[model samples]
Target chain A: MRLSYPTNIRIIKVPCTGRVAIIHLLKAFEKGADGVFVAGCLEGDCHYQSGNLRAKKRVAYARRLLASIGVDPERLAMYNLSAGMGPRFAEIAREMTAKIRELGPFLQPSGRTAAPQATAA
Target chain B: MIMAKAKPLEEILSYLEGFQRILVLGCNGCVAVCEAGGLKEAEVLASALRIQNMQAGDRRDIQELSLTRQCDKEYLAELKDKMDNYDAVVSLACGAGVQFMAEMYTEKPIFPGVDTCFIGVTEEQGVWTERCQACGQCILAETGGICPIMRCAKRMMNGPCGGSEKGKCEISVLVGRDVDCGWHLIFERLKKLGQIGRFAEPALDKDWTLSRDGGPRLIIREDVRP
Candidate 1:
């Protein structure tokens, strides 16, 4: 049971993954989260029957939405695991942190960090 | 409910390119039930637009508002006081609602955010099929409650022409499934009820004046008027 995740990773708990609406995920990105991932119960093992399944669909939709607006769809993800899989949870956290690191920091809305354009002499 | 589908983000973005501040309006009517232009959809759109503008290093103020019903004048009037806050309004209602908004707010630009599909019923959670064409005459009793005018590709009242085979309509091939022929469905339903003989009774020529052919027909009921 010796494991650690990135210091920057923050987790928000919901009653069920199905309760994680598409707007909630998008709000994370709008507020400048580099990446977001949903960890729900394993497929066919949802406590509320199809709650996890609904979360899967919502995650997919959020991915498409991000892609449609020119944002990288890879910024969002969905993972299914049983409640007892503590190792899997840590693994997912590590994976998401690594992916976000590779993607680098999200730029501010004021265009301050944009790439330098060459000017004619 | 009036079914509709969201317009592509690129198209919506293009429409808003000229404006810095915009209102992405939603309707809590048919579009709400269809999950097309509902409050959730409006919020999603607003967030997407914000993200888009943020990434592009530009400013876009998108206010999301969901009205009771955009098709109704009383509901649209609620926004009359605050209409000047934005440059234009992107309507997330059906075509009729969009047109009505345009008519109501003649001074402002109104853009449609969804494609009005059909007058239909939800078959399942995410599936909707056309049910009524508003053909102006009610013939559902004779057709076993299945409307051939809307279901049949040809709109044939007396149907199952040469295209019907194996209980599937000819156009089913193009639609990617074996759609049951309209008349075939009638025949089966009537046969089960021991009323198959009704199929032979020719339906008289329908009145075209009551339908769209009459040039945007209107109904005025003196009995209900105040």
Candidate 2:
């Protein structure tokens, strides 16, 4: 099925969401991404057994780390969906795009603004 | 191994307010084992500082370096030429390592990126509990291998104080968790060894001089001083 999502969203593929470390998430904002999210296999349905669950914990940890550094924790998020959920993926893309837009550009601790872009990795 | 935790980013950043060229140093010794200060942590800190500086509209040069052991003079010598390039250094080593680094590089200010907690063993993947206080005395043989100095909220040489409730130390209330009473563990261990009678024998007052109370202690082992 052909589906269209927000064009501002850039998707980066990985072997599994669990491979996404806290540094990777912070790098997105460091490089000026307004928002970043990880879309993994549905809960308890990870291909590598518990990769998605691990990713969930990492995402939460990254969120807290961001907050500690004065970055908005809401800018980072995690989502779980099966491989075949094309429509759901598109819907999430749209939802995230709107959320990032509302949050405006990612602001550095020093009050400077970074260009707006949303990333899903 | 020595256990430590990363200092808050805000605190680390505070130490670098005026510094433009900075090095976030990591040690691959005890700190690395505890997942506190290692190559990965150095990279994380460097990245965070860069992002913070970028937001502040300032151009700062931040780099990452990890040594085999910052406490060793040989390992710290690796920074000889590199130290000249940075205005300041943030060490992710324990308190001792940080001081050692500062001693060698007298010109540049060295800040601690992690707060050294204690000598401990990993209880699990992410949990670390203190195990040793380095009191300069060996009492484990008599205590059945459990240390009261580190485990007991109040270091009681001859104890199982009145505050012990259901095997938990009374201080557990303040910590919001059941902390094993060290004496209780000692009692149980002695019972299993058929030496429960030893528990009643009053231990002599501990020699405070052997511990930190006597100030900084040193051992010059001639055999190892090559």
Among these predictions, the greatest lDDT belongs to 2
RMSD of each: 5.9, 2.4
Candidate 1 on B1-226: residue-level lDDT in tens? Answer: 8999999998998888789789999999999999999999999999888888878888778889999999889999999998989898999999989999999999888999999999999999999988888889988888888888887888887867899998889998898987888888888887887877777788888887777888786789999988
**How does chain B score by TM in each prediction?**
0.95, 0.98
Name the best candidate (by TM-score).
2
What is the DockQ for all candidates, taken in turn?
0.62, 0.55
For the predicted complex of model 1, DockQ is 0.62
Alpha carbon lDDT of residue B52, candidate 1?
85
Clashes of each: 0, 0
